[model samples]
Target: MGRIIAVANQKGGVGKTTTAINLSACLAEKKKKVLTIDIDPQGNTTSGLGVDKNMVENTVYELFLEECALKDCIQPSVMENLEIIPSNINLSGAEIELISMENKEYLLKNNLDAIKNDYDFIIIDCPPSLNLLTVNAMVASDTVLVPIQCEYYALEGLSQLMHTIDLIKERLNPKLEIEGVVFTMYDARTNLSSQVVENVKENLNKKIYKTIIPRNVRLAEAPSYGMPVNMYDSRSAGAEAYRFLAEEVIEREDEDAWL
Candidate 1:
């Protein structure tokens, strides 16, 4: 079965969607079949992969609200081994729509079961808040990967996210675990960036990825052109960093399987 990972951070502009897009793309480049599910109503992940939100027909909105099958919502991306379940503004109302349903948290988990084995990895880009959408993503995922920006107040929001994860493990999905914490938008020249990295590594309980995502202009610019950093600029620092991240993840999985 495919490993489901939710790339989530309640704090916005922390490179959550960027990591989701590039990581999925990078893994696919390594010949792993990957599926990226954009549950964020903003649909940055959908557009980042070159899919226009306005042109999308079967989106994640229908999967939750209309009880559509997972296969019906899947769309092929421009990348060779990558597929995506795109989302748009239509998913903004999913929180309210999901509230009255019974066992609402398990909706995504149950729905993804039938298609879980069709890929090597399923990555979910969650909305930037702890709502029903995020809860559903966590409930459906095996682990959650957090992207923390190396800026002021970075650690302040982490406690709340960890608390939510704990609650989900206890009440909804005990198998859920934190996959890792990655530092994003890191400027090595800044003392604040070094300080943030030190503080996070010293305080955060989860494994911190060795790959630190630099503040590269290419990373920011790739989305505007509707492409991942690797495809946009394979030689760029941002692309290399994400490629290293994918290797680290695969290595960790191998280690886990041995244990």
Candidate 2:
């Protein structure tokens, strides 16, 4: 079965979508069959991977509502070996609609189970909130990869997210584990960035990836161009960092398989 990972952070503007997009692309670059799912209503990951979210006939919303099959929603991205299940504004009301549905939390999990063996990795770009959609993603995923911005309030609300994860693990998905945390927007010149990293290392008990994504102009500009940083600027620092992160992720997966 494919390893399903949800790239999530309740805090917005912390490079959550960026990590999801770039990491998926990098994994595909390594020749891994990747399915990147944009569960975020904003659909940034959809567009970031060069899919026109507004143009897609079938999206994650339709899949969630059972309007379409999971395979129907899966669309090929511009990048080879990377496919996407796009999302749009239609998903914004999913939380409300799902509230009345039976076994709503397992809806995504059940759907994904049928197609899990087709890909090597399935990366979910969750909405930047601990809403019903996020819960669904958590219930569906094997692990959660959190992106923490190297800013002053880096640790704020982190405990709440951890608590939410714990609750989900206890009540819904016993297999759910934190993939690890990756630090983003690190500035080499700033003492604050270093301090923030140190602070998280001291306070957070979860695994932290050694790859720290730098605040690169290319990384910020890639979304506008509808391409991942690796494709937008392969030589850039952001691309290099994400590529390294992908390597680490694959290494960890290998270690897990060995055990």
Please report, in order, the local distance difference test score of every candidate based on alpha carbons: 0.92, 0.94
Best by lDDT: 2
Off by over 4 Å in 1: 254-259
Score candidate 2 by lDDT: 0.94
Which residue runs of candidate 2 sit more than 4 Å off their true CA positions?
254-259
Model 2 TM-score? 0.97
Candidate 2 on 103-168: residue-level lDDT in tens?
999989999999999999999999989998999999999999999999999999999999999999
Clashes of each: 0, 0
Alpha carbon deviation, residue 227, candidate 1 (Å): 0.4
**Mind giving the per-residue lDDT tens digits that candidate 1 earns over 184-212?**
99998899999999988888767888889
* TM-scores, one per candidate: 0.96, 0.97
